[model samples]
Target: MEILSKEKNARNCKFKTRHGEIETPFFMPVATKASVKHLSSIELETIGTPAIISNSLVLYLRPGLEVIEKFKGLHNFMKFHNVIFTDSGGFQMLRPAFLIDYNEQGINFKSPFDGKKFNFTPEKSMEVQEKIGADVVMCLDNLPEYGQDYESVKDAVKLTHAWADRCIKAHKDKKQLLFGITQGSVFPALRKKSIEFFNKKEVDGLALGGLCIGESKKKMFDSIKLHAKYLRKDKVRYLMGVGSPPDIVNSVNEGIDIFDSVFPTQNARHGNLFTSKGKLHILRKEFFKDESPIDENCSCYVCKNYSRAYIQYQLKFKEGVGYKLATYHNIHYITNLMKEIRLNIKENNFKKFRKEFLSNWVTKE
Candidate 1:
C-alpha cells in the first residue's frame, strides 16, 4: 500500500500488503496443495517466508469444496494466517496428458484422484477462489504449451482476456484481490497486446504467465522487461513459476514483485542447498569430510546446528530429516536474500548489492 523505495536499475518497489509488508523482489514458496513440500505452515513462518502459493485446481479436486467449506477457507484450513495467493489451476489442468480436455467454452478436466470429469470456467474459478478465501486470487487464463503456432497463441490470449473479464464480474468479495495473468507464448507483440488489454481491465494485480515452461532465459528476461514497461507500477507484478536465486534477483531487477516455484523444495529433496554464494550439491563425495555449515553466513537453524558432512551422510542414508534440513536452509537463504535486497533499496544501494551478489553467485562454479 505504500512505496518504501524504488530501485534505480529496475522498476522494483517495496510495498505493503494487508497481511504483512512484502519486500519487492521476493519469492513466494510454492505450497501447491495447501502445504509446501515436506514443510508445515509453522515451519514456513519460522523460516521467515513472506508468503506462499496454493493451487486452486488441486484443492478443488482432491478436498473438493466440502473440506474448505468446513474450515471457512484455505487460510483457516491450512492454519497459515499470512498472505496467501492462489493460482487459477489453469497451468496444472493442462500440463498432465490425461488430466484435461480443452475447448472454447472452458476446460473440462478430469480429477486426477477419482477420474471424475470436472469443468472449470472463468466464473467457476472466481467462485472457487471466493469460497477458498485467499488474500490474492488469479484469473483463470488459458495457458498454452510450448511450440504452439501464432494463431493458437493469439486465441489463447483472447480467451485469457475474456476469462479475466468474467472473473472480475463473478468476484463477490470486494475485500479479496484479483490478479489477471497475461498469456502469450514467446510473442512480444502478443505479450504487448495482452499487457495492454489487462492494463485496461484494471485488476488489483498483474502476473506474466506462460514463461519458464520451455522458453530460453534470454526470451524470458526480454519479455519481462517489455511487459514491465506497460504494467502498472502501483499494483504488484508477479512473474509466475520463477524461484531460483539468480532468476529471482534478475527478475526483481526487471520489476517483478512476486514469484513462486517448486525448485527449492524439489532440488532440496535431491540434496541441493542454496547459499549466499551459490548453490551447493551436498550429496557429492567431496562433502564426506567437510565440517562446515551449509552456508557460513546463514543463521538458519540448519546452518547453526548441522554441517554439510552430516547432511550428506543423512541424505546418503535416505533419512527424512535430511530433506527437512535442506528445505529449511534453502528457504531461509532465499527469504534472507530478499530481506537484504530490501535493505539495500531503502539505503539507495540496490545496484551495488545486486552487482556484488551476482558476481560472487555466478562465479561459484
Candidate 2:
C-alpha cells in the first residue's frame, strides 16, 4: 500500500487487503451482528460501499467462531465481498449492561445473549478477529465513556497502551492488517501520550477512539487536531464512531482516513433524514401533501422514485418499507459524500469544499 495523493493535511490513500484495496478517506457503515439492520448486502453493494464494520465480540457470543470458520471467513458468512473491518469489542466497555469489570486481564463482560460472564483478553480478541477473517482488525483497548473522572480516563489510557502491547504480540495473522486505537477522552496530554505510544507500535494503522461520546464538538475536534501532527503520516488514521456529515467532513480535514458509526442508520429509523438542503423530519405534517423526493439532489433509489408524501405516509403508519428506504438513502448519500471528498482531496481543493460543506449542511437540534 502506498499514499496515492496528499492535499495538505487531507489525504487520498489506498491499501490492499485480502478482499480488495480500500481507498482512504472512506466511511464504513456499522454492520454489527453481520447485518445493517433493515439493509442487506445487496443494497449495500448497490450503494457503492467500499467497506463495512462488524462487532466480532457480538458474533463470538451468538454464532461462535466455529460457524464463521466453517464458511472460510466473515466475507463468506456475511456474503459481502468487500473490505470488512472487525472491532475488538472495546466499545462494549462503555455499556453498563454488558460491562462487568476492566482490569489488566482485558475486559470482563456479561453475554447479552445468554447472561454468561466472560473474560475477554487481548489475545482472545486477536484470535476472534483472525478466525472471523476480517481484512482489518482493531486492537482491544479500554474505552472510557464520557464524564468519567480525569483519573479514570488516564487509567483507561494506560490500560489501552498495555492491551495494545499484548494485542500486538498476540496477533499473528499475516494476511490481516492490525490497527491500534488511542483513547484519552478530553485530555490533550493523555491524547498525545496515547498517540505517540501507538505511533511506535507494530500496527498497520492508528485509530482515535472514545470521542464524540457526549463531549462538546469543539473538544472532540480539539483532541483530534492536537494529536493530528503526532500521528504517523504513513499509516491510516481511523476516527471511530463518528458519522455525521459535518463531523466526517471536518475530521477528514483533520487528517482522518477511516470512520464507522451506527448514528446515521439509527437516525434514519427515527425519522431523521439527510437531504441536500438539511436533515428532514419525515413525520411532520408539512410533508403530508408535498410531492417531492426526499432530496432532489440525490439520485438514490429512494430519491429517484419515492415521493416525500409517500415516505412520510408510510413512516407515519409504521411501515417496514419506510425504515428500509430511509436507511438506504442515508447510506447512499454518505457514500457519495465520501466520493466527493476524495475527489476534492486529489484535486488539492478540499479546504475550499470543506468551507462550503460546513456552511451548507444544516443540522437541526
Candidate 3:
C-alpha cells in the first residue's frame, strides 16, 4: 500500500496485493457467503469492481476450510482475479437474539446456517482468514451495539484493542495482510483512543468498524472526522460497511481509502436504484411507460440495453431478470463514481467534484 499524492484529505494512492494492483479510494462490493448476491463473478469483473470483501465467519461455518483449501484460496476458489478482503466476523458474533455470547476469551454462537454451535476466538479468526487466503484480512474486534451506553462502548473498545494484539500474534500468512479494527461507537474520545491504539500496532492496514449500524448521518460523519486523521498515513484506511454516495464522499474527504457495503446491491434487489441525478425506485407509477434507460449517463450493459419500463415490469412481475439487471447497474454506478473520484483527486479538483456531485445527487425521497 502506498500513497502517491494527496489533495487535501482526498488521496491518490496505489494498493498492491498478491492478486493485483489497484488505486486507493476504491469501493469493494460485499460478497457475503462467498458470492455477490445474484451477480456472477464474470459479471462483477465486467462492471470493473477493483476488489471485494467477504465474511470469514460465514465461510468458515458454511463451506468449511477444506473446500477453500482445495482451490488454494478464496481467489482461486471464487475465480476472481482481483483483490479480496475477508472480515474476521467479529461483527457477526454480536448478532443473534439469544444465542450469541462473548467474553474476553472469545465469542460463542450458534451457526445460523446449520444450528450447529461454534466458538470464535482471536486465534481462530486468524486461522479461518488465513485459510480463506484473501489478499487482506481483518482482526477480530468487539463491536458494541450502535446506541449502547458509554460504559459499554468503552469496554468494547478495550476488548477490540486487546483482540487486535492477539490477532497480530496469530496471523502468520506472509501473503495476506492483516488489518486492525477500531471500535468506539459514536464517542469521539473513545474513537481517538482506538485509532491511536491501532497506530502503535504493526498491522498492514486499519479499518473503521461500528459505524452505519443505525446511527444518524450527523453522528457517523462526526465520528469519521474525529478519528480518520489519527490513522497511520503509511498504510491503507478502510471504512467498513459504508456505501452511500454522500457517505462515501464524506469518508474520502476525511482520508478513508477503501470501503465495502451491501447497501447498493441490497437496495438494488428491492428495486431501489442509484443514479447520477438521484435515487430511483423503478417500480414507481411514474415509470410505468418510461422508455428511458436506468441512467442516460451510464454505459453499463443493463443501462445500454434496457429501459426503465422494462426493468419496472420485470421487477413488478417478480421476474429474476429485474434483480440481476438492477444489481448490475447499481454496482456499475458506484464503481464508476469511484473511478471519477480517483481522477478528480489526481487532477486536484476533488473538492469541486464532490460539491458538484452532491449538489445534484438526491438520496432521499
Estimate, for each residue in 133-240, the C-alpha lDDT of model 1 and write its tens digit. 888899999888988999999999998888888888898887788889998899999999999898888588889999998889999998999987887677778899
Q: Find the 10 residues in a row with the least total lDDT in model 1.
A: 9-18
- Tell me how far the alpha carbon of residue 261 in candidate 1 is from the true structure, in angstroms, after superposition: 0.9
Where in model 1 is the C-alpha error above 4 Å?
9-21, 98-100, 363-365
Error of 2 at 229 (Å): 1.6
TM-score between model 1 and native = 0.96
Question: Native-vs-model 2 lDDT?
Answer: 0.89
Candidate 1, lDDT over the whole model: 0.84
Q: Give the top-scoring candidate (lDDT).
A: 2
Expressed as tens digits, the lDDT of each residue in 119-149 for candidate 2 is 8999999999999999999999888769999
Cα-based lDDT for every prediction = 0.84, 0.89, 0.88
Alpha-carbon runs more than 4 Å astray in model 3: none
Taking the tens digit of each residue's C-alpha lDDT, what string does model 3 give over 1-365? Answer: 77887999888799778887889899999998888988888999988899999999888877889998999988888888899999987777788742468899899988876678888889999999998988999999998778999999999999998888999999898778888888999899999999989889988888889999999989998988876667778888889999988889878999989999999998898888999898998888989999999899999999899999999999888788998999999999999999999999989999999999889888643
Off by over 4 Å in 2: none
lDDT of 3 at 56: 90
